[model samples]
Target: MSGDDGESTIQRIQDIVAVFVLSITAVLTAWCGFEASKWGGEMSIAFSQASSARIQSTAAEGEAQSARQLDLSVYTLWIGAKADEDDRLADYVEARFTPWFTPAYEAWVADGMVENSPFAREEYVPPGTEEAVELSETADEKFAAALENNQRGDDYSLLTVMFALVLFLTAMSQRDVKTWVGRALLGMAVVLDIVGIAILLTFPIKI
Candidate 1:
């Protein structure tokens, strides 16, 4: 073919490629939005399920604590003087007090003298253990949520990146300006990643 005819064929191919790239990018962006919405719903369900399971578990454990008791002698034995009174008191309280009351009383604090009642005394007990357990439970819930969301988010991210790559392959893909839009889309992807990270950080409460 003549030189002019060959140049015309190349230009036609470039135009076709540009159109294909634009179409692909638009489809990917729309798909990402759709997937993100779907992921939000899945995460909500996971949160609810996990929360319910944990509350049920806590109730069951509390019930188990309520069904046992120590005879007076056993109670005395458990509460008997020991070098480390705290251990003795914990055992004493666990043996005699009702499940609901025991943990609370065990955590109480009296005077500086440190009189811990096995059954019902005052002492300072840190709530961090309970909080940690609760936070761990919450974290599990959030992690499950993130798993669902991130999976979908990852798919969206992959498509977005793939579309960007397609744009790069086009001769008239608007190198400088469309590049800005691509960056914006990338920034949105980063936002999704940050959200997943936040869920992980807040899930295990700092106690």
Candidate 2:
């Protein structure tokens, strides 16, 4: 072929490759944006759940504290009545013990005071203690999930940026420039596209 024909063929090939790269990069960029948005939503949901669990845990803990105080006060009153030799008042206080407190008090008495006081016994589980622990654990898991979702969103955002760079390079490659420079830019764009796609494939898809 003549020199002009040969240069024309090269130009045509470069245009084709540049157009293909631009199309693919545009799609990848759009997909990355979509995934990032989805991950962001997941992060929001997880964070909201974590917050709710934490609040519930706090409320349950409050209930437990209130129960503990009430039980302590009643037990103290009973002790005072006993010290004053008022069996009737002591019986009244014992009868008024909360159901949960009664179990611990019974266990304490059954064990022959091996554990000091009812409050000191392992059997003295306050109301809502188990619920508070479970809710706190759930909150921790949800918070961790939120962090992971945030990280996933960031990864997609990073990939979107990378695709944008590929688009820029592909567009630049289509510009009028020295033959080698255009080819170099195109080659770089293609390589970056491959890397971005590989990374994209490794990531978990939301939709």
Candidate 3:
């Protein structure tokens, strides 16, 4: 072929290659953007959940504290009832204390006569304490889950930034350098973009 024809053929081939590279880079960029957006939304939701869980935990802790105070009051009442010499006063205090104890303990008190009885000294777990503890534990679990989701979101964001860089490099390859160096840079960018996309796919998508 003539020199001019050969030049035309080479130019056409370069145009085709540039178009292919640009197209793939555009698609990858869009995909990375979408994934990053999804991750950001999920991260926000996770953080919100964590905040709500903390609030619930705080409320439960307050309830637990109140129950402990009530238990202490009951103990003091029982002690006063035991020290009283008048039977009627002792009976009145015992009746007031009955509502504070659990049903099982109330039954024990009724059968054993708690004043000066062996069962009177037995530890009493106030109502609501167990439920409060369970709420606190649930809050901890939710917080941990939120942290994990946030980390995943960060990872996806980093990959999305990397994909943006790939798009920049590929676009520059078309205009800045006309030699083998340009092709080499484009090749490297394509490889990096593919790797980033693979990693993004491996992460579980929320919503």
Candidate 4:
């Protein structure tokens, strides 16, 4: 071929390569944006759940504290009645305490307290205390999830920003630099874009 024709062929090849690189970069940018948005939404939901769980835990804790005070009052009244030999007062104390007793302790009492009473040894928990502890644990789990989702969202956003950089470099390669250096920059941008896309695919979308 003539020199002019050869140069034309090379120019056409470069144009084709540049177009391909730009197209792929555009797709990668869009994908990264979607992933970042998804992660951000998940983070928000997790934060809301964590806040609600924390509120529930706090309320349960308050109820548990109040119940503990009542338990203490009942125990003190029972002791006072027994010490004073007031049968009627002791009966009233027993009746008030019955609702707080666990089913096993109640059964033991029904069996005439022949064996060591679990209630007497204070082995059982109050009704709401266990639930309060569970709520607190749920709150902790939700908070942890929110933190993790927030970090992942940040990572995705950073990747999206990197993809934007890759697009800028690739576009610059066509106009600012037209030699081998420009082709090398385009190649590097293509590689970076591919790697970013792969990472974006690995992350799961929540909701």
Highest TM-score model number: 2
Give the per-residue lDDT of model 1 (tens digit) for 36-117: 5666567667777677767665665454344323323444555463444778575655566445445544454333325444
Q: Tens digit of lDDT per residue, candidate 2, span 1-207?
A: 999999999999989999999998999999999999999999999999999999999999999999999999999999999999999999999999999889889999998978767999777888889999999999999999999999999999999999999999988887888889999999999999999999999999998
**Tens digit per residue, CA lDDT, model 3, 95-164:** 6653446554566666675555323544444555566667667767777777776677677678767877
By TM-score, is 3 or 4 better?
Answer: 4
- Candidate ranking under lDDT, highest first, comes to 2, 4, 3, 1
lDDT of each: 0.52, 0.94, 0.69, 0.77
lDDT digits (tens) for residues 128-155 of candidate 4:
6777888888888888988888888788
lDDT, model 3, position 200: 71
Model 3 regions more than 4 Å off:
1-14, 85-87, 98-100, 103-123
**What TM-scores do the predictions have?**
0.44, 0.92, 0.75, 0.83
Regions of candidate 4 where Cα sits further than 4 Å from its true position: 2-4, 102-123, 176-178
TM-score of candidate 3 relative to the true fold: 0.75
How big is the positional error of residue 107 in model 2, measured in Å on the Cα after superposition? 1.3
